[model samples]
Target chain A: MKILLYIILVTILLATSSARYGVVAQQSKVREYRIANEHRILEEFVTLLSIPNVASDHVNIRRNAALIIEMMRRRGLEPRLLEAGNSVPPAIYGEWKVPGATRTIILYAHYDGQPTDPKQWAGTMPWQPTLRSAALEAGGTILSMPKPGEKIDPEWRLYARSASDDKAGVMAILTAVDALKAQGIAPTSNVKFFFEGEEEAGSSHLGDIIRDQKLLEADAWLICDGPVHQSGLKQVVFGVRGDTNVDLTVYGAKRPLHSGHYGNWSPNPGLILAKLLSSMKDEAGRVTIAGWYDDVAPLGETERRAIEEAPHYDNELKTQLGLARTENAGKSLLELINEPSLNINGMSSGDVGALARNVIPTTASAVLDLRLVKGT
Target chain B: MKILLYIILVTILLATSSARYGVVAQQSKVREYRIANEHRILEEFVTLLSIPNVASDHVNIRRNAALIIEMMRRRGLEPRLLEAGNSVPPAIYGEWKVPGATRTIILYAHYDGQPTDPKQWAGTMPWQPTLRSAALEAGGTILSMPKPGEKIDPEWRLYARSASDDKAGVMAILTAVDALKAQGIAPTSNVKFFFEGEEEAGSSHLGDIIRDQKLLEADAWLICDGPVHQSGLKQVVFGVRGDTNVDLTVYGAKRPLHSGHYGNWSPNPGLILAKLLSSMKDEAGRVTIAGWYDDVAPLGETERRAIEEAPHYDNELKTQLGLARTENAGKSLLELINEPSLNINGMSSGDVGALARNVIPTTASAVLDLRLVKGT
Candidate 1:
């Protein structure tokens, strides 16, 4: 009887080990596929960039969306164009269902780019791609801050429109899938692709798309629009912060009051707004809203551990950022990058620069972007 | 012997009490003088507002500075005018000595006002001081945002350039001094005034002057620039945030690149800069710079306690702020307002608005305004 019990235990252990091995093998295949097809991904991204998909004048927005759909269909995937809103360009969705897969993952990217100006472009037109020696880069239209002890490698850059912002990312995703199919490997989990065209214009219609379609039901959602972090490490991002944009107007008198007469007695709405904003935060980067942090989600243990484990630069890297010191000192890189934030995007009051006037401005408007953490 | 001792004690106690009462009586007199002179302060503010002291247009700025100096001399104070810079306007300095005073406070105000457009002002010009009905307080160039809940009381408002800014504050200080003089009361502390003309032009030369002149020495500085808190409470501010403006350019190639050919491989500087900025701050208000907060002076117990004790709006007030929830939702008013912040004052790349082209911008630029707290 003891021998029989030992045999059963051994058998169970062997089966569990084999299953784990299979899973590891599958993950390895995915990694290998992505690595080998980097060049192919680059090519595809270049092709997409060739298309003029400027958001405001969207002559090519639909064309690019259709092209993406065609690519997906050519790979034996069922793809559809989703007209989420009246004014916005359509979203392209493609799905591959592996029979009996219990989980699903959705990939997202944007296909639109900002319009170009001919005057701003020096070597090549805004639409034409150009290559330059690293030394010539400094003279290009875009100016980069000279970093200490840093040398630019001209060969590494492919200068063009929409390359890094999102097109490259999109290409990376497609190429990654294409590589898997070429290797005769079927994905373990069902996959869905979402290509949006309105991200450049605030994604104004995205919320509606999310609510109405119910089409993107998946176990996980992956945003493929952002670039790889500076460290160039393969990242697994679990969450993103929510955002809200606000325009606040503080009204004073019906008209602009003379600063001389009303400076101390009557209120200057601009100063009032400044004082109000100042009251919301202190010198140490702590927020001052009455209940601003009451519901803030604390960093979880797993996240903290992962962040600590991630590769990071020391003082040398900090200097590259031109930062004498970090803002939220002592926090890990991951914590800072993944956390939520609030920012004053822009503020306009009266005249600015040589045109600055001392009139107590009648109206001061500020554009604020507030970012929220996943749990908070 | 015991009775004699009691008698002596009683006499000493009476003498001490009388001395204390004398000091208290003097303080009450001064307080009453200030209160009684409130109307005079308003009147002086209005008078100052009548002058056209637009900084951009030089003629009135010097005139107003001269007027301020003349007024100071009339008050038995020594006034001097110093050129801000060879190109900029002049600044006025005034000093008064109070016998036996151990402390000195520097008072700051600007004489220049913002330029006004005649087309925007209704029923009055920018330089004309008009007293409209109590229901109409806003009048000037289209710059000023009207004060909320500000009763358009003709009795309260003086319509002219520089009405509520430094002009009115300067008038208030002068009027306060006048009231004290009339009551045969003098300032308990030595007073020094630093009236600036180019403050409307960024106070560019003020820093150099502050560093060079011992004539402006004082124990503390008082900047009567911005208004009181939105709650109408009187506040004594101890510090002002310093600002640094940076124009960052992203260099791509010598010329704008066509999006089609090099989209994936080319380095688009605009996209790069945007990504760079986006990466610096996460969804939360936290900046991602390493050690950014190390140099920041933490809020002291005394300061925090004082801020907590100060009057503040709770949930109802926040609701009135038009916020469903505040940014950094759990922070105190003191914590959020006093913190250092980075603002994207403006960003330009290719075409930002309706004019969308497909060219890769050669250069992208962004204007950054960093608000510095203590240690920054």
Candidate 2:
């Protein structure tokens, strides 16, 4: 947790370097504080990780929000829950004001985690944080938490659902503020901490929450989510594609029919659905839907330059993922993400396995996920 | 039961007339026998229908075969069970020999019924034969079975699974023989009885049973199955489309992944299946699979004439079936039946209804049923 805080703060510090020497001194002070208080920081993070934070899980998610609010209060940030409605998970709003601060930076993170099935996890449960000497893939053996005077390895891994997702962002952002306060750093921009509780649930109520609360007025928002660069540097994404989903269904006869007596005579809903879905994309993995790409705005000069300068790591990604080829039509991942995309999230009809019977199903359905660029 | 037997025997007699006067006389004698022995014949049929004859229900199917064999024994036909190995329903074989007969005709029918869900039946169960004063759709009222010496209404509907399918064939064919014997009339041709026990399950083991027994040698097989013509004259179909089934499955990533994180980068199995299935047919509902219709044999002059003379009931059928348009490129249902066909029996991937989530499925699958005419 201490090491994670240093990396997140380093990313923020590197981006806002008004003076190189002054930033280096502040970085050293934060590092010194983190090292001195490693046990306490790790314990606080472990406490946070112990709580189940699935956004839709109302009771446990509320418990998670309460714990984080208390953690913020301990840091003297005057934390408050910015509720979006009765059922929606509330964002934790807090501020650290500095004397004579010129600008305000909203340090953004999320406290919620993805919905996970416990059985899918390897040798561990999703909410139970287990410390490992290294990654599980690297033959790491589980170990107990270190005693106060015992040595704690910064390289040790923690296994849990949100141990590395937005929960780590929450931990890192809070610990960074703790380190800054302890080191007595002064004359920096006032930092407004905004820890969202529903980012993993696609943050459907995010805009409503921000508008309703009116507490996000700031110079810039620094999101402490997503992965670092593949080259092992902090990745600072300029923008991300907008994501949304749609459900599709096609009908056939009102009731299931014997395929032999009917077959081609009565329409098969599965075939109808198949034809419909297939018409949306071509053989080259490009969408053929009429005017699908028409509304997409082209990349700006700086955006094009940024894509060009990004690492040529497509092959590395493919290799790591055990894929022989990719859906590439003279484009890289960085360039392709700038456009729109359509994907079948899921689909179903009658049955496919042992329970499958020889009857034409009445209906077929699918869930489609669409990623949009600027206009589309 | 009495009226059904009369129509079936009339159809048989009408097709095999050496002299029109002789057939008419025999038909009257058969009608007299049925009229007098209606109660006994109905009792025997009810006993057969009471056994749940779903082809896959091992115990019940065998009970049906056993009951049929006993019925043949009561008629002194020297009945025997032609066992089709363990785990397969057995066919019941019996014969009646006429001295000086130059030809033998096999009366073919199936005792086994389709796999039926009783809940779908209206006001009745699949195995419980229920009598109604009229058709169920015409506001039929449930009626008790007639007492001994009471008048029987021949037009009353007897509802049960396989009541109109091949089980009715079994009853009509068997009762016809009883009528002939009771009236002291000998068939011009020697008759062989072949009551199949597993026609509804695609008869996968039928060839093995026939080859193993070698008891099916005959001049002709008169299969008492299918429906009467739309014009209500007893129908005679020269041939039917041969049916077969195939299961299909398509691949995707090894595990479910978040659509936002993976989406277009990972190929969705549902889309792959959709594209593959769509490639099989076009807008006019003709299969586009390469060489799909290459082996189909053309109809002869007699078959072509028969189709032309057959009622053009396509429009009526469409209206009855609640369809605005039929898949008619330029041909009728009769003409299309003469060609091979491909249909999706069923298909599935991931969740489609309430449980559908934003994850790319691991696999997609479909069951295809192909119908063949003469060659294809």
Scored by lDDT, the top model is 2
- Residues A326-362 of candidate 2: C-alpha lDDT, one tens digit per residue: 5545677677767788888777787664445567777
| Runs with alpha carbons beyond 4 Å of true place in candidate 2 | A1-81, A87-204, A222-234, B1-202, B222-234
lDDT of each: 0.57, 0.78
Model 1 segments beyond 4 Å from truth? A1-47, A50-64, A74-76, A98-103, A112-155, A158-162, A182-185, A200-204, A210-215, A252-268, A314-317, A337-339, B1-376
Interface RMSD of every candidate?
Answer: 11.8, 2.7
Q: Compared to the true structure, candidate 2 yields what TM-score? A: 0.72
lDDT of 2 by residue, B1-376 (tens): 5336644665458335738787677677666777798889788888888999877889999999889988889888888988768799998899999999899888888998867656657889988899999977678899999999998887788988778777888888778777767667678888888889888778988898899977789988887776655345555677788888788898776666566556667677888899888888887788888898898888999999999998887667666555555454467877876778887866777666444556777788887778887877
Error of 1 at B208 (Å): 23
Q: Categorize the docking of model 2.
A: acceptable
Q: Candidate 2, chain A: TM-score?
A: 0.87
Quote the lDDT for B247 in model 2. 86
TM-score of each: 0.45, 0.72
Q: Native contacts retained per candidate? A: 0.04, 0.52
